[model samples]
Target: MATIRCCTCGSPKENGKDKKNRIEMRKKTKGKTPRRISLRASLRASVRDLLHMKSKPAFVNVSFKTDSSRHRFIQEEIAKYGKGNITSRIFTYSELCEATKNFALQNLIGEGGFGRVYKGYIHDLHQVVAVKQLDRNGFQGNREFLVEVLMLSLLHHPNLVNLVGYCAEGQQRLLVYEYMANGSLEDHLLDLPPQKTALDWTIRMKIAEGAARGLEYLHETANPPVIYRDFKASNILLDENFQPKLSDFGLAKLGPTGDQTHVLTRVMGTYGYCAPEYAATGHLTVKSDVYSFGVVLLEIITGRRVLDMTRLSEEQNLIRWAQPLFRDKSRFHLMADPKLEGKYPTKALYQALAVAAMFLPICL
Candidate 1:
């Protein structure tokens, strides 16, 4: 080895090379520092932008005139309802959207003529809720919304589905209800998928009794009496324990009062479930609901759809098919759900069939 120099003291040539290397390293770092800073800033900015987008409001109104006035009117009307036992909160449009995960398709649990219902988890309340958002394109409108709000807010019954809250912001109209884990009775009875189990006779009878009680409450207990023009299997929602609750008050109308035989209005209900008189003439009454209740009861007992095209042309309509059977006490056994496999008591079957027959429209 050549003569060893002090570690701190380098040869001139070595010093020159070391200095050059240090400068190059500094230059490289200096060049990349701004890029690194920009990248971090860019990431922060991106995050901010994403948050801003999510924070954007739904159904925003540039002119608040109409909305404010209408909102005031709604609040006034609701106030007139005297709160009663209705403790539904008025939720913001944004709150509902967030609760429903912006109304994601995957969150949708059910849909019908009224609108689509979404299953939502409300973080603030720490509860799951059913959010029913009315379809703008559907037959339902503000009138139906108001009817539902008024009817449900004023009426409280064990058999009635609970109204948790409502959202009436801008053009958006939504109703929030307690979640029914078991879904609708129609889901269990008709058009059932292979995976779904048929409802047992005991559950079916329970559902029928609960649904009848719901109708009875509307027709008798409610002030001015209410005619549930839209009563059917689909409107009967079931909880985890298979307890039934009446839902969808959109088509509900006040029953006739003081010697009035019926309330005359535009007829609106599911085709097969509508009472013949109500369908022919827009005359509605508690009896109309009774007729509908009968149809649903018949469906429960027979395990047939209200309108099944699969049957022979003459036997397609459940009411027409059952009418003849209702006349002969011996034929009542034939009306029992085949799924029951004759497991139910014959006496119980006769009594249930008699009740259903009592509800049928007497054809002159």
Candidate 2:
């Protein structure tokens, strides 16, 4: 065979045989050599492209000057119903049944005019949540459920109870909410004995403020404005931190539009908390909520039920007893809960009382 030189070493070797062997070796080496890809270089290229690309325009431009304006802007944004936003979810009755152990009585938390609330865990979020399962016999049917879903999907505030999601399967309708560890304000204020001392004056003030913020958000902020028909202590839930959150939307309605003073509707609400004008004339307005808030404020102050027939002869009805006290600053001290042991600041308490008292005339 003819002589040949090695490609690397350049050494003279056998002719045809060595040349053939070297070529084969070269092919094998090329096959074994790994191709290098620089991830850093590719990333740099991607960043450059992103920096050069033109950004898409925003869906909407919003401007606001006052708290009311900010609220209106948020409401308008929510009404847009942008794509990829999850409004609500549908879950099979079997899934919910499994979650609540077939709606067992032991899992029940509380029962309301609308339906029963139960404690449940969602595997997807790995979090504990309260599930309100609407009873088929409830006065509010699918219409109320849909209204609640739409309102909750658009409304979001720290003091307002959040609507995590909803489920509609067959005859079953369910609403999921973040679990309130401390339960409702009514449970601590009215159900629990005075000896419990769980809700002190400070906590009561904080709760009142938080609940007010929630109402203000709904009234001044929500798009088209919303009137919470059922605004009572039982519907205000307390979290582990004692922060109050407004809930229960089965009786809620959209507030009045245009320059009309009030929207006339069928009278619906708890006895003691309903506004006088709403009860008598079936006309509702934002002032109706203010009236209910005043009643809640009274409950926080005097440690009394709105309508307690079992009390002492003169103090049977709390509103009637407190109305006169509200007018005379000299009797303001008597309006506070005696269990407070005179710990609350008189000035702040009086201010809150004044705010609540102003609602009486407006509501009437």
Candidate 3:
């Protein structure tokens, strides 16, 4: 992996001691409630209901900063990354074409609304990677391409997909990522071939835990918190060891900060995973991601797609189908995937169902 200097956008400005802190300091000298609780102002308290605090994140110092245009911001941040010891490499279009066998169909591994992704081997790095070639005709595709590039480039985490490099030669925009051998969680979790072995309860829990940590890092640790607008199974890729890493940052948004409560943006995300509040109003918050995480958690436990038209009309929606099961604790076990054949621990299943149920939105 090429070295990307992952740091906050701007220099941190210290807050001056104000009247409130002065008074609090007096009280503290007198040995009462401390004046200033924390410089970050109990950041977790606001989203505690959704996030449920457990542990502190690895400390990295970076404060929130924004530029006029997202494109300019991406360019600036990436430029900063370039000053580091080993900067992100800029791959030529022809180099990537050579790697992917001239974009042949046989190497294709994944496709989405953005465009097609193919498995390729880069000779320079002598490493296998996934090359995502963006749709040339779509203007939005270009913006998304840049956004994904900026996000993966700036943000580095164990649970987030690594961006090996990118090819922006001419009009060709493509992203090179570390090849995920196990494909997506959706590949093995939801629909499985008759011959494939089902994912055990332990692995399912581990995947959920890793995914949740990735989301939590975005929400709590990023310089300016990031709202992962799109959180679903297909977006969570698994590695050779079944370790889950969150992917696809095109839909991510810089979350609200200071006094701001949420970000306002057009509704976008996989249908079944969109938070009801986000769908009803464009107000996007870290909780928007938490809600989507809940949906995925349910999917992990049940091994069902968020939406399926082929299913019975009532059960087509996974959340709604889970309602009665949540209401009746005795029936919670029924929500477990039948393919498991009752191998999961009973206590763990109940706790998982409860936590998943808690993640769901109140009205939805």
RMSD of each: 29.5, 26.3, 11.7
TM-score of each: 0.77, 0.73, 0.77
- For model 2, the run of ten residues with the poorest summed lDDT: 1-10
List candidate 2 segments past 4 Å from native: 1-86, 361-364
Quantify all predictions' global Cα lDDT against the true fold.
Answer: 0.73, 0.69, 0.73
TM-score winner between 2 and 3, please give it: 3
lDDT of 1 at 180: 97
Positional deviation of 364 in candidate 1, in angstroms?
14
| Sort order, TM-score high to low | 3, 1, 2
TM-score of 3: 0.77
lDDT of 1 by residue, 298-320 (tens): 89989999899988998899988
Model 1 steric clash pairs: none
| Candidate 3 or 1, higher TM-score | 3
Clashes of each: 0, 2, 1
Q: Mind giving the per-residue lDDT tens digits that candidate 2 earns over 1-364?
A: 0111111122243589876898898678753543322112232222223223222111112234664544334323333332224455545667677777888999899996678999987788787888999886886555466456655655678888888877765456788888999889988887467568757777888888788888877775554457888889999999999989998876776666557677677788899999988999998888888888878888887778888888897898788888777667888999887777888877777766776666655221
| 2 versus 3: better lDDT goes to | 3
Summarize candidate 3's per-residue lDDT along 306-351 as a digit string, tens digits: 8988899999999888887777778888899998899988877876
